[model samples]
Target: MLCGKGLVAGYLGAPVLHEVSIDVRRGEVFCLLGANGAGKSTTAKCLAGALGLRGGRVTIDDVDVTAAGAHERVRRGVSLVPEARHLFGRSTVRDNIMLGGWTKSRSHRPASFERVLEMFPQLKRLLKSRARDLSGGEQQMVAIGRALMADPRYLILDEPSLGLAPIYVDAILRQAAELARQRVGILLIEQNVGKALSIGHRAAVVETGRVVLSGTAEEVAANPLVVDSYLGGAA
Candidate 1:
């Protein structure tokens, strides 16, 4: 449902992504695996319209969104949950989630908020709580719930497992898998190689700003380069 072809993007004059390309199919979990500075986030930024393409194309369900800005892309059913989990620290959890649907009419916000709560029952109990007081796991849930309030067709998750305990990471990965089963196209950027591969339908191994390898989960798991580089020979 999403594709980036020969994408080149970066901050200022230094290019971080060099001709990277990948595709995410509907109802599938597509994993982008790479070390820090491998341009995984850069590729995601370009695909989600958070960064402009210096020389390439980004298409959503075959529609050219290469020139579209972030808000326009979100309107077209693309939403991003960045690595930083940028929640409003001073705001209530409910308010933070509601802000995600700001692009929608007032009539639709309540329903969207309820939908997010359904996906994350814990948030329902903490609606009035300040975002800064939540645990890492809860904060991550708020971040994801906020994006879901936008009602996106394709969800881009960047390192959702970052800085979390093993159980929390497992829970988040499981939730991500469930989202895929619900027909949401997920472009997952995960540092937890084993867990990501176990849930992902397909996986791409990136190195030096390029997609060095890509295939079905099993195929990628068997690749020596992938196992050595990312999986620590556990394949």
Candidate 2:
């Protein structure tokens, strides 16, 4: 399990997360649902070690990693794909994806490359293409493929489907589900509530940096508050 217990963090001395906590179990998709500015990104940063924690601790497989840095977390098989799809415009898709294997031995990269391609075959022909030239959906795939190069045990994806067409959104979500099936714990932060819940094994709704609701996906989907609020009366 990848667990963040009582996470307390903020920016510039101002708090954003008020002791928020979450757990990601291997082979399952744990969804975090919330409106903008509800601390979802902040939480992902904390889990990914991109930000510091003012309080609480993060653990993986029962080992304390609260003090570890981002690089160390990545070395420990935790990879994060932020929403921005930060690819090097001048770099080829292959180069950008290969960069993710920085922590691994050079001999391990080829195998990892093949593995990533399995999840994103569309990237094969685009290997020589510059990241700046790909469509939004393709760039997103590269970003995710880059993260996969690390062979992460826990993958944190922040708003992966944002701004994507329906086809791309479905592809990304399906890939996430496939990763979960491969026993990689997934912490998915998404805005498409209905679609997210469809693949999520467990989920939580955050509001103002706090978890307002949490349970099995079915339970959360069935909750009256979620139906009225997040599901928009569609559930």
Candidate 3:
């Protein structure tokens, strides 16, 4: 299990997150849903160690990693695919995928690349294609592939479905489910209430940096407060 208990963080000493807590179990899809600026990304940053927490505890498989930096955390099997999908615009798909293994030993790259190819065969032919030329969906796949190359135990995805067409959106969500089934704990942040409800095993709704609602997917979807606030929103 990966967890954050009473996490608090922000920039310039101004807090954006206030005592937020979450739990992600291996092989389970634990989702965080909220509107823009709800501190969803902030929480991810704190958990993934992209930023430091003012006060909290972050543990992976019962090991305390609250003191670990981002690179150290990555080495410890945590990976983050931020919302931007920050691929090298001019690099080939293969080069981009290889970059994610920078934290690992050179000797491990080949096996990691093979594993990624197995999961996302679509990248096989696009290895030489420049990242910028690929469609949005393809770029997202490359980003995910790059993360997989690291063989992370915990994957944190921020707004993956944003700006994607329905087909691509469906594909990304399905892949997330597949990763969870492979025993990777997934902390998915999204604005798409309907989609998260459909695939999430457990869910939380963050309001003003706090978890205002959390429960099994069915329970959250049926909450009047959740429906009134987040229903009918597009990814």
Q: Pick the candidate with the highest lDDT.
A: 2
lDDT, candidate 3, at 145:
90
- The top-ranked prediction according to TM-score is 2
Tell me the tens digit of each residue's lDDT in model 3 across 128-197. 9999999898899999999888899999999888888888888889999999999998888877778877
Error of 2 at 120 (Å): 0.6
Residue pairs with colliding backbones in model 3 are: none
- Which 10 consecutive positions of candidate 3 have the poorest summed lDDT? 226-235
Candidate that beats the other on TM-score, 1 or 2, i.e. the better one: 2
Instruction: Give me the runs in candidate 3 sitting further than 4 Å from their true place.
Output: 233-235
Instruction: Quote the lDDT for 227 in model 2.
Output: 91
Q: Residue by residue across 1-235, what tens digits does model 2's lDDT show?
A: 9999999999986799999999999999999998899999999999999999999999988989999999999998889999897899999999999999998999999999999898999999999999999988999999999999999999999999999999999999999999999999999999998999999999999999999999999999899988988899986
> Model 2: clashing residue pairs?
none
lDDT of 1 by residue, 26-93 (tens): 78999999888899988888988999988889999999999899999999888999989899999999
Residue 42 in candidate 3, Cα distance off native in Å = 0.3
What would the TM-score be for candidate 2 when compared with the true structure?
A: 0.98
**Lowest summed-lDDT stretch of 10 residues in model 2?**
226-235
**TM-score, every prediction:** 0.97, 0.98, 0.95
Alpha-carbon RMSD, each predicted model:
1.1, 0.8, 2.0
Q: Which candidate do you rate higher for TM-score, 2 or 3?
A: 2
Per-candidate total of colliding backbone pairs: 0, 0, 0
